[model samples]
Target chain A: MRWLRYLGYALGGILLAGCVAFLVAAWIYRDIPAGVLEAKYTTPASRFLNVDGVRIHYRDEGSGPPLVLIHANFASLLSWDDAVESLKNTHRVLRFDMTGHGLTGPDPSGDYSLERTVELTGRFVDALQLEHFSIGGTSLGGTVAMHYTATHPERVDRLILLSPGSLEGRSMQRAGRAVPKAADILKYIAPRALAEFMLTSRFGDPSRVTDKLIDQWYEMWMREGQRAAILARLRSYSSADIVKVTAAIRVPTLILWGEENPQAPVEQAAELRQMLGSAPGVTIITYPGVGHMAAEEAGPAIAKDIQTWLAAPTVRQKESVPP
Target chain B: MIAARPQLLSLLLLMAQAAAAQTQPAMDAKGWNLDTAPQSKTATPAEPPSTLNMRVYKDFDGRQQRIGDTSYAVDVSAVMTRCNDGSLIITALVIGGQLTPLDNHCPTTSK
Candidate 1:
């Protein structure tokens, strides 16, 4: 009887300890103040446009032919900071945070589907009165760009895809299936630490994962409703849906793939080439030792390739189309 | 034992309370808000691509049978050729019966 009482005490103590630990973790990892993130991330060039009840945060720089750039999942427009700098001199560069990302906050409709993103892109272009423009995207952004061009072929002149997501490959198919489940689990657990691990793992060279970069990403994730929005977006993604629309894109496309991309494997570039083979102009370039974040990993080389491709006769002719 | 039962019941109740508190939604934090800004009536663009471009591909059935004396195979569905200068060219099997020139090098032929 005494032993039973001791066992009861032991069980109660263990339960108490676990509850305290969980409470402490939840408090510590609660969303950081939005003001703190804005102070750290908002730049002088930062501007906002109201698009379909979503306040889009964007940056428009330089002067020339208009070029719209979109970032990958869990990344903001700042992902294209280097690429924008490299291209702004010769081309008008526009980069914006997609809905549910960066400071854009969550969509009221809670529709983070690729179709919603495509619609947002179109509205954004229309808002800017960009009749004919070139578009580039990385990762999920790449997938969005392909879908955008497929639907609005007349508006998009050239398409630049860097490590675009695909369902054709076994690895990416598995990733597509795994992401929503992972996001569901992550939304309820310790998100910041897991997100940091994920961000670091995506880089081929982990040394590139700087403290400042991690801090920015962590702060962005801490934005109110950002976590839920990310989960919603992840849940909405369908690689099979993307693979289908990508084939119909008629604009000139330049695919820059990292040789060792883990998330969207390098082999998908070949599959993309096959899908976009019917497009009038298709150029595929592979960087020998880069990873998924090609825009950040190989910015200079990518920028140079993009500049050359944009200036090429094929793209120039396409750019001349009337609004 | 009666006294111990009362103590045990209290401990169990406390444990249940702690578990409930811990499971509460994190969004209910005091300062958190949805941060809704002034709504804008920016004209929504025309509906974007809603349907998938489900183009069906003709399935080819065969094993690794060679296509004549050339380095191409019926099963492989790829052609390999060695140039006069020792360069090699390989063809890709395009779906939908379209064969585009794939500018990739063949490692086997190069060796």
Candidate 2:
């Protein structure tokens, strides 16, 4: 009886210590920047598209030619809302929530890799029946677009990347090197609350965090098996196996970066330019005072540059589609 | 004032268009200017039609495209320069007519 009493006290002490450590670590971890998620644009055309069994919510409006825009991780189609509306009067813009983020429900299979996203983009284009189109993406999406262009140059007329995930395959390899295997499990423990903490830290300015946006993000986090999907994505990121696909991109690529983008600094963009050196025409543009959210922070400026770059009217012309 | 004349005129035109468009909720003036092309719901397997139309709103210096007011509704792609801060705006909105400017006109009040 005495021994059992002592064992119980020992277990209680261990539990108490673990709780204290977790609370303290949580407080310290709170310092990391979380991303701002929301439908910030005033555009009413934002809707969802059911493509490949995923209800991809997108912002589709405007008039002229077609331009498909892809957003980075932890972002939705709303990230491109400002740029889309600004250019919609003269250009038709397509911006959608990728498989895992935004209103687009989580992928039940948890296949959020760049290759999968590239396939999804192709399906999106096919679904729209766009034979040839100009495409641009930011962060993770940029890497996927670059890969897609390399593999299916026939489909992509022009490509633009904004602070793409990794300009060089080595960066991804390096990122994969440090991925924590069990860290993702923490993503599921009290997920809704933890996600709030994690996402809020992605932003430099916490004031950008809004109630509506937080609610939306929380809802998405709690969606069917989202925690598992996030874990799967983390596992994919840690695999560090993005070389063969990225090494083969051959399209005209434009790499844009924010001078202050911390996640993917200017060096990464330079590395991307170096890797795709064999491409016909690859241009790298950098802006000052911009961060990971360069498109949103400098949406107006980024949009204008893209318009000019696409209009240079110098790329190899393909057979015109039937009018 | 003459140098400012074009900008003032442009602003007024934009404001008037915005106001008129606001009046007729069902009818959109911007898309109206686009070619009356037929749109089908079924996805086309063939090459997409060249509905590409490019428009450039040059900066006040007449060097680069103007920002803020530039439309992605027409061009296959566009570059805009913000008139106020003079920043470069790169956009891929024109390629497949994916631009949506609806949010710019909405109220700040959440729906």
For lDDT, the strongest prediction is 1
lDDT of each: 0.63, 0.55
| Cα error, candidate 2, residue A219 (Å) | 4.3
Model 1 bad stretches (over 4 Å): A168-185, A188-193, A315-323, B1-111
At residue A318, give the lDDT of candidate 1.
14
| Worst window of 10 by summed lDDT in candidate 2 chain B | B72-81
What's the i-RMS for candidate 1 in angstroms? 21.1
Best DockQ among the predictions, by candidate number: 2
Cα lDDT tens digits for candidate 2, A59-87: 77776778888887666666675677577
Superposing all C-alpha atoms, what RMSD in Å does each candidate have to the true structure? 23.1, 15.6
User: Residue B81: error of model 2 in Å?
Assistant: 12
Clashing pairs in 1: none
Chain B TM-score per candidate, please: 0.21, 0.20
| Candidate achieving the largest TM-score | 1
Fnat per predicted structure, each in turn? 0.00, 0.01
